[model samples]
Target: MAKEKIVLAYSGGLDTSVILKWLKETYDAEIIAFTADIGQKDELDGLEAKALSTGASKVYIDDLREEFARDFIYPMFQSGALYEGQYLLGTSIARPLIAKRMVEIARAEGATAIAHGATGKGNDQVRFELTAAALAPELGVIAPWRMDEFREQFPGRAEMIAYAEKHNIPVQASAAKPYSTDRNLLHISFESGMLEDPWFDPSATSNEEMYVLSVSPEEAPDQAEYVELEFEQGNCVGVNGEAMIPLEIMEKLNELGGKHGVGRVDMVENRFVGMKSRGVYETPGGTILFAAHRKMESLTMDREVMNLRDSLNARYSSLVYNGFWFAPERLALQALVTESQKNVSGTVRVKLYKGNVIGAGVKSHVSLYNPDIATMEADPTKAYNQNDATGFIRLNALRLKVASGVEQNAKK
Candidate 1:
């Protein structure tokens, strides 16, 4: 009988490289390492050679950038989903797509099980497993972090490093730089090292070499530069009036926003596991998208509808943050959000300078902003209903009048 095979999501990182080697030894089964290139352009370099050298029977590196941006990013963008008030839900949205593909590869390769390096404590574990549960219920999930045997053998990063050394498995990182980081096209997250301290100010030190995706805000251009974002059904289609594809639009916005230091956030956020964790994120294009989409909604969406959705946006964000992406309630909220964006087709001009995204103007074919009804210059005689104010005010003030009458009677 053929040995049972497990397809592991490999990143060629320390944990994953060690996991790849450990899985083969412990399971005594064929291990196929898979890497998804979802906009982690430079990070994917040498992944194939690294996986193979780390004791993988086979390696697959799939570039899911276009699909990532178009399918996952665009739909979340449509919902205007922000994990917190500040976070753009970057990591939350990428997991399902990657896991979906993982299941696909598992079936294609005849692998009985799929594995990931996500630790049991983090949101990634939930995201990956929930997606697997949703998409491929039949495939067994091998999460080494949750396994007692794996944890006993490799208690932490130090143990993993020792095991890697003992097994001759090559890892790009050492025990010195022990910070855990996840990167993709949408954004990159840094956590679990020197960052665990809540009071740790990432911006306090002038570590010019450490910053990526943007320059220091002090170095941003003095003058604000305006860019127009065009969207159709909430999916960004163009920048500054020139039509472009999804990835192209993102690249353009990142270039423009990063040049102006438009997207950089550091916060201590509540993790799904009831623990608060500090994170530093740079979401240049996503920042631009949020600004432009908000401006567009201000002009296009109905006041009550917008208010209703805005009220629920926090709950929606909490669901996404808490790893409820596959939940039915989230889907229902998403459907409502999608319905809200049907009229959210428009262009919004934003001024970016020194990390500030100011709304300059907004225009949409579906816009509810009627200049005729709003303009101060409009003729007062015909459209104005100044005479109706007396009855309107009297009716509105009845409750107050009744309360005042009762007070007056008591005083008398």
Candidate 2:
């Protein structure tokens, strides 16, 4: 009988390199490695060659930066999806896209199962598996980390390193390295290892070098720089008056935001698996865009509509963080959120100074903020009459008055 064919979401990282070799040796199966280039920069350089020499049948490397930025990042931003009011959902958002592409590769390669290097404890496993369950339920998921046989053979990094050396698989991880990083167009996240210590500051001393996307705040230029962000229907379309595609926009924002040391977050976040994990992230471009987008909405969005969306944004963010990018409820939220952005088109000026994105100004053709009716000085335009406020206040205060009277009667 022919050996079973499996497609592995390979990153050419320490864990994946060992998993690739083990899959071939243990299962006696043909393994195809797929690496998605979603803005890891130098990390993608030798992935294809490395996978082949380690015993994979073939390797697939594709540039998904544009798709990632346009489809995943932009739509999520429309709802202003920020997990727990802080996280930009960078790693959380990228997993489903990677898994979706992996499923596609598996189908095209005529593979029986899909596999990933995500450990059982981490959220990535659920992300990868849930995407598979949602997209291709027929394709079996093989998680070697959860398998007792594989775990016993390679209990930790030392055993994996020994196995890689024994099998001649190339990996750059050392036993002493203290953290793992995941990078994409939107952001780069560092977690595990020494980062497990919630009290540890990754920005201190040599750890500062761990930041790849942005500089430390202390090192940023003293002079604040201003940039204008232009949006069309809630999606950031350009920067500094230049129209750009999704990739160009992100690249430009990343460059500017990094130079200003904007968007470094260190926090212990609650993971879906019922534990808190400390992570340090650099999301320069995403932070800039998110700030500018909200400023633009302030000019064009309706008050009640904005409030209602804000109430649901937390739920929307949770859905994205929990790997429900393809779920029905998230889709429904996206639809409602996108509708709210119909008039959210404008330019927002932001000052980037020492890791802060300060709102400078905002203007829109359809802005609800009318100076004629809002100015306290005079009624030159007669747009709003002050006399109308008497009835408005009385009507609104009627319930309060009645409640006060009822309280007094009860006391008596």
Per-candidate TM vs. native?
0.92, 0.97
Distance from true location, Cα of 342 in model 2, Å: 1.1
Worst 10 residues of 1 by lDDT: 202-211
lDDT of 2 by residue, 1-412 (tens): 8789999999999899999999998889999999998999999998999999999999999899999999999999989888887999999999999999999999998999999999888888988988899999999999999999999998878898888888888889864667899999999999889888788878886777788999998999999999999999999898999999999999999999999999999888888989888888999999999999999999999999999999998899989888888888988998999899999998999999999999999999889998877888896898888889999999999999999999999999
Candidate 1's displacement at residue 21, Å, is 0.7
What digit string (tens of lDDT, one per residue) describes model 1 on residues 31-92? Answer: 99988888887888888888888888899899888888888787677666676678998888
lDDT of 1: 0.83
- In candidate 1 the C-alpha lDDT for residue 393 amounts to 96
Residue 108 miss distance in model 2 (angstroms): 1.0
